[model samples]
Target chain A: MSPSPEILTPERILEATEDVLRRYGPTKATVVDVARALGVSHGSVYRHFRTKAALREAVTARWLGRTEELLGELSEEPAKTAEEKLRQWLAVLFEAKRHKAGDDPELFATYGVLIQEASGVVDEHLLVLIGQLAAIIGEGVRSGQFAARDPLAAARAVFDATARFHDPVYAPQWERPEIDDEFRAVCELLLRGLRA
Target chain B: MSPSPEILTPERILEATEDVLRRYGPTKATVVDVARALGVSHGSVYRHFRTKAALREAVTARWLGRTEELLGELSEEPAKTAEEKLRQWLAVLFEAKRHKAGDDPELFATYGVLIQEASGVVDEHLLVLIGQLAAIIGEGVRSGQFAARDPLAAARAVFDATARFHDPVYAPQWERPEIDDEFRAVCELLLRGLRA
Candidate 1:
């Protein structure tokens, strides 16, 4: 062992892996390359994560975590009326997705390619997001701002209803001049639909 | 020139091209293969469609036309209330999508692959479906059963809102046991939203 090789922590491995992924893309990026970037052996990296799939999951989860944290603030905010909160939440979500799809298209494409292979991380991320929407709707129902029988179900409905604005499959349409107008129109209809 | 080359027609060529697409799939099915399937020269196919792209566009449009015709009946139905028409319309749309996604996954996938290559056929198809939706919403507004200011905009909003139920990207989620429940719940909320 070289005298005091930099400490092998999961955090360091993840950062290195993300860097390697940025360079080689999802398809060509390998655990060994990540290990090389970290100046450690592949076995050292695997000690923290059982498999490459696990490592990928951790990385994706990390990326999605950022978005969730940002939204979590809105979900927990106590001041805004539910209508205002819902509108802000959705606009922020759409903007966040647009930035992800536009800012670093290469990284976004890498995530798109790797997402299928990452397995439950994406599903879990979705559940977390839907849960956030549920919390807001639950509050809306409690305050008599919405008339839904079930906040969880209502949250899911709103989420599904706005899929075109946020779903990666429709990302190409985001560049159209009328996307914002369409988003607002949908939001208006949904807001009207959800009002008590 | 041959005495009789089976008297090729555009309809017959389209029928054979559909068969070839079903057999070889979108990626592998070419103009030459379609021509070979028709027992004619590629030049003969070109004479009708001008280019291979034109042939692909024609085949995709024909397939989409079937769906448009199916929904057109519901859009024009004058007997039912707007609410019932909307409910029936959504259910029928969901069921149709489910059948397309579930009945013959290979054929569905072939269509999915070919769709990207078919240019504006999918967009035109979307406009047709949205127009059907607008017709129903317009009647609702005129009857004072719905409060939407712009029926066309409301139709688009509703269409985008229901993307999860019909969008091919979410096709895998259609298999979930809870999908029907989720769809109905969304429909209920949307109906409530649209009510005057």
Candidate 2:
């Protein structure tokens, strides 16, 4: 039988790193720890990532890549109003939390670190995405699809509303299958807050 | 000189604990840490609280106590509109972050924890406060004093908007001295979104 292509690409490595981060935290996770989880040799990991920091960077890149995809989908979606797009984004975030791969310990540990780096490094892609969202909001205001106000400021508030989803404090309580109702309540509130 | 009761009470202990928490996270903070910071002996601290967990509970109580005070102030702020009260609540949260006392690390860490806890354990209180905000909103809608929408849902949106002020992810960027401008903008958008 033909061998399946090796799954240890840089992206896959980063995914494993995210799992390790979630399971063991940055302080405890090691190259061997990550390799064992990925079913690869420690030396194989070293071939692509020379240091833990390098691997972390790759993982962060992967996360941003995912965020970018969501943003792209948001921009591409045929939502008629900014409010609809905002709701779409909220749905994406909620699903991201819900659909988290089971092996996401390293990703969880690295999650905080990634967010901090994005803010500090002026995560340009995030800024671009924010700016795009703001533009849509501005268009909504001009088109009388939303209230006329500072689009950028409104965009920030919407982003903050999603922050609660990432919180471990609430995430645990939200693990129940029935929590979709609460999630819908939150999303509806944001949409109502954004309505024209 | 007379000791004059040493000028410390359970209240003072709780306040000092907040300071210690701001300096160190929950892991590093101990009753002794609070004691030393408060300029009191370990025996005095033990006299008031027998264990670290007890002290933490007191700290949590104090934090809730402060939130209650803020809620009281909002109720009496003479705000003519729900938007006005919402703006005031945003200001309260902003102030909490800006003036978190004694470099309180534990208090800081626990703030998010406390928020989540309130949602679950203190749902009645949260819902009541939200209901009150909704009443103001309903009044505004009736008089054409503000945008007309489902006041209860809008009230909930206002609370969710405050989630920004509580999130640490945007702490550095959002907790600026002049957040009032951005806050006002959000209020304006929400008001517009609710406009009939």
The TM-scores of all predictions, comma-separated, are 0.95, 0.69
lDDT of 1 by residue, A42-157 (tens): 99888999999899988999988998999999877778898889999999999999988989989888888767776688789889999998888888899999888888888989
Taking the candidates in order, what DockQ does each have? 0.85, 0.42
Write candidate 2's Cα lDDT for B1-196 as tens digits.
6867568788888878877776776667777888888788878988988776667766665565666567656756663565566556667656676566326544555565544444443555566667766776786778676664577776776665555664453555554655666566555545555555
Model 2 segments more than 4 A misplaced: A1-28, A32-50, A77-83, A101-122, A135-144, A147-153, A166-170, A176-196, B1-51, B79-82, B101-153, B167-170, B175-181
Against the reference, the lDDT scores of all candidates come to 0.88, 0.65
Task: Indicate the residue-level lDDT of B171 in model 1.
Answer: 82
Q: Write the per-residue lDDT of candidate 1 for residues B13-72, one digit (tens) a residue.
A: 899999999999888888899888887789989889988888888889999999889988
Which digits, one per residue and each the tens of the lDDT, describe model 2 over residues A6-125?
757887787788788778876687899999998988999999998877777667666666766766677566636666776666677667755552246445535655555444333665
Best of the candidates, lDDT: 1
Question: For model 1, what TM-score is found for chain B?
Answer: 0.94
Interface C-alpha root-mean-square deviation of candidate 2: 2.9
